[model samples]
Target: MASSQEFVQYAADQSSGAGRITYRKMFGEYGMYCDGKIFALVCDDQFFIKITNAGKRLAPGLTETPPYEGAKPYFLIEDLDDRDFLTEFITATCSELPMPKPRNKRKSNDTVPKRRHQNDF
Candidate 1:
C-alpha cells in the first residue's frame, strides 16, 4: 500500500524544527529530505529514518525495521508526537550522512541519434 499524504505532511511538520525539511514522491512513497539530503522515507504510512551511528548514540532505544522488502533496516520511529526528539534525531542523522552529489544534466544540444536499418544505410 502507498503512504498517505496526511501522514507525510505530519511527518514533515514534526521535523520542521530540524531544518529545511522537504519531501518528494519516490517509487509510490515519500522520501523526506532535510537541507537537500534525504534522511528518511515514509513508506506504507510508516516513518523509517536512516540508521546511523550518530542516531544509535542519540536514540539507542529506538527500534529498527526495513522500510520495504529487501532493504536495510532503518530506525522505526514510533514516537512521532515527540517533536523535540524528531528534530534532534533528524539533525544527528543528517550530520552523519554525506552530502548529496549534484545531479549531472545533459547539455541542451545533446541528442540521441536515430538508429538506421542496414537497407536505409
Candidate 2:
C-alpha cells in the first residue's frame, strides 16, 4: 500500500527543524530527505529512519524494521507526536548521512553509436 499524502506532509513538517525537509515518491512509497540527503522513508504510513551509529545512540531502544522488502533494517520511530524529539532526531540522522554525490550530466549531443552489421560491408 502507498503512504498517504497527509502522513507524508506530517512527517515532513515534523522534521522541518532539521532544515529543508523534502520528499519524493518512489515505488509507491516516499523517500524523505533533509537538506538533499535522504534520512528516512514513509512507507504504508509508518516512519522509518536510516539506522546509523549516531541515530542509534540518539534514539536508543527504537525498534529495527525494514521500510520495504529486500532492504536493511531502519529505526522504526513509532512516536511522532513530539516535534522536539523529531527535529533533534532528524538533525542528528542527517548529520550522520553523507551528502548525495553529484550526478554526471549528459550532453545534448550524446548518443549511442549505430551498430554496424556484416551486410553493411
Best by TM-score: 1
Q: Write the per-residue lDDT of candidate 1 for residues 44-86, one digit (tens) a residue.
A: 9999999999999998888899999998999998889999999
Show the lowest summed lDDT stretch of 10 residues, model 1.
Answer: 106-115
Candidate 2 stretches greater than 4 Å from native:
110-121
Instruction: Please report the candidate that would top lDDT against the real structure.
Output: 1
Stretches of candidate 1 off by over 4 Å are 110-121
Task: State candidate 1's TM-score.
Answer: 0.89
Give the count of colliding residue pairs in each prediction.
0, 0
